[model samples]
Target: MRLAVSALLLALVATPAAAHFQEILPSDDVLPEGGTVTIDLVFTHPMERGPTMDMARPARVGVMANGAVRDLTPAIEEKKVDGKSAWTLSDTLQEPGAAVYFVEPQPYWEQAEKKWITHYSKVIVDSYASGEGWDAMVGLPVEIEPLVRPTGLWTGNLFRGIVRNDGKPVPFAEIEVEWVNDGSVTTPNEAFITQVIKADGNGVFAYAMPHAGWWGFAALIDGPKTKAPDGSEADSELGGLIWVKASDMSAASKLLIKQ
Candidate 1:
């Protein structure tokens, strides 16, 4: 199963035709306080049409926190987006509480002169502190517990699952999904389906299926394979299968996965 999924992902190396530059990180309205946060930008183009042109020059990222602007050129990494080379910038969040940030392709640069630029993306920060004793008691400690949630009907097009780490809700973990239809398995890249969205600041994930039928949906979280004290690792096979029925989507469904 792992090999099949990996092959499917690798098949997506071809670049999409009409590339659209967008921000992929700092997507949440609230972020945990106190830690280095990395934001990534994703450039997407239409794969069905033709390849998007490679960026001739490097792009720039502009970061603003509490009315202070900082140039993020040093942390920029050049990489391929939808098969075309693109630029990415990563930045860290300091201090506590909420802040706003944005990213844009450098307009003054020679290459970005004629290219279309993306709108600014916003980010909100929430308090996250690490300590011990009474402070630890007030601070949110990591918990790895089972999650029980409703699947909202056996809609063959949807799969729902609960996520947790060390008995606590795991917010912000990535969830990748694939489906097995009849005797054929759909790869992540080949499957004409929407991406599985991870749970919010609370461990929860859901995805809509592409087709109706007896499909076996599998999920792999970018967490640890073995159980850990703090519940952090790339454990994909932790949460199991989710069954759905297209015709009976109106009926409420429930799912429970234990870690």
Candidate 2:
């Protein structure tokens, strides 16, 4: 894998933290009327809501919809967040189906941990309420197969998925969860920043989102050990990341309390 020359070069010895999350966020996750959607590709600490990292030009970006794959690499535009490199892809939905947009980003050299990080991230957008393709696997090297439908989820709903490595279930995988914070919420401690969970014996993990907004689940595994940028040996970290949104239940769906 080609390492991103522009990744955040960690020269100083920083404190240990594991909140980096690769994001493939869309303007809208479910489009009932069908229109344009702008997807933002960012690498940051979503729960912290700041300190975005620079992301080099991705290796590949594409979408799977209507049983066909569409290469979207040429359409991605460079966008900066916190004065750091990022990307955005805008597309108009014309079909009544789910578009699974995914990206394979260039490997980032994390000098703090002395490892190479390669996170393959993806998100699903349902156009015109089409739910036929939300579960379609993009066949990523490391991927999360959604057991529960990923789209049109209500707030506080439980999400379930299986972590897979090369199309095979991982017996026990470590998954990190984080919610996209909009500055409206605050955490009392660092432990609340990134929620960590482990997959069951069969590689199935479940998370119930308590609030509304986008949630990211990343399953991490140790990749092949190789030489680092300095020609020294280092371990590689491979992550399979997926994002899903949840909305609050409408008041009409609530029942009146009989006083």
| Best of the candidates, lDDT | 2
Native RMSD of candidate 1 (Å)? 19.3
Compared with the true structure, model 2 gives a TM-score of: 0.90
The 10-residue segment with the lowest total lDDT in model 2 = 5-14
Clashing pairs in 2: none
Name the top TM-score candidate.
2
lDDT of 1 by residue, 1-259 (tens): 9999888878655432222323334423233455566554543322222234455443445554545556676777878756876666545666554333334333211132222232222223333421111101101122112122111124444445444434455676555333323334343553343234566676666666554332222232332344323443322223322222232433222222221
Per-model C-alpha lDDT, please? 0.39, 0.91
lDDT (Cα, 0-100) at 11 in candidate 2: 21
lDDT of 1 at 23: 33
| Candidate 2, 92-114: lDDT as tens digits | 89889999999999999887788
**TM per candidate:** 0.34, 0.90
Q: Give the RMSD in angstroms, all C-alphas superposed, for model 2.
A: 7.2
lDDT of 1: 0.39
